[model samples]
Target: MGHPAEVEVLSKALSGIGVDEKSLVSILTQSHHEHKRTIKRGCSQFFVEDERHFERWNDDAIKTLKAEFKRFKALHFMK
Candidate 1:
């Protein structure tokens, strides 16, 4: 899924008003662990820990969310 063409498909799926759920699900469900790892690694290169959406959250809530997201990244990323 890290291939240029696959990235293009995912970009399209994510950039629209509504996601193309079927395409996204098909790609993910068919992927092997290594393929999913490739996808994860590729994604981290572009992923940002944006906090703008959480501006309204209390500091503790925001901290918790960020901590959880960090843990998720560490657990799933192919280090």
Candidate 2:
């Protein structure tokens, strides 16, 4: 299947209050392992740009946000 902008999609998924966990799941799980690696690396831009958005959130959201990414890595990156 044709892949759209991997970074862009990931950026959107990671944007807004808290992480878009569902969107992350839909995108990461559908992509190949190599593509997942690409997504993992490309996540920097999203964090840097959206850092302010996440900053207002409480520590719990911060922890949950990390957990969300870890979930993505576990499901998509781990064999």
Candidate 3:
């Protein structure tokens, strides 16, 4: 079980990415242990770290978002 403060911080960070609190909770709770571990590691590494680390994480996240958007648009036109 995660600490309450950690959970709250994670929820707020996820919200910044446009994820709703309920869905975030559901995803975190229902995911595999490996997934949870990875997320916990990433949250500590990216969110709680210094500003440089956060900026780097944010930049990579934006790149991933762009790639996903491109893939989504490509699939949208498929018959």
Which candidate leads in lDDT?
2
Kindly list the per-residue Cα lDDT of model 1 for residues 1-79, writing each as its tens digit: 3576666676566443545656667877888888876775554434444567422324553464456556656766956
Clashing pairs in 3: none
For each candidate, how many residue pairs have backbone atoms clashing (under 3 Å)? 0, 0, 0
Candidate 3 residue-wise lDDT at 65: 46
Cα error, candidate 1, residue 48 (Å): 4.1
Residue-pair clash count for candidate 2: 0
| Predicted structure 2: lDDT | 0.64
Candidate 1 Cα errors over 4 Å, as ranges? 45-79
- Judged by lDDT relative to the true structure, which candidate is superior, 1 or 3? 1
Error of 3 at 29 (Å): 1.8
Question: Which candidate would rank higher by TM-score, 1 or 2?
Answer: 1
TM-score of each: 0.49, 0.46, 0.31
- Candidate 1: the clashing residue pairs are none
Please list the Cα RMSD from the true structure of every candidate, rounded to 1 decimal place.
12.3, 9.3, 10.4
Tens digit of lDDT per residue, candidate 2, span 1-79?
3245767766776666546777677887788878776775666543333355642334554576798777767877766
**RMSD in angstroms, candidate 2?**
9.3
| Model 2: CA > 4 A from native | 1-4, 45-79
lDDT winner, 1 or 2: 2
What lDDT score goes with residue 13 in model 1? 60
Better of 2 and 3 by lDDT: 2
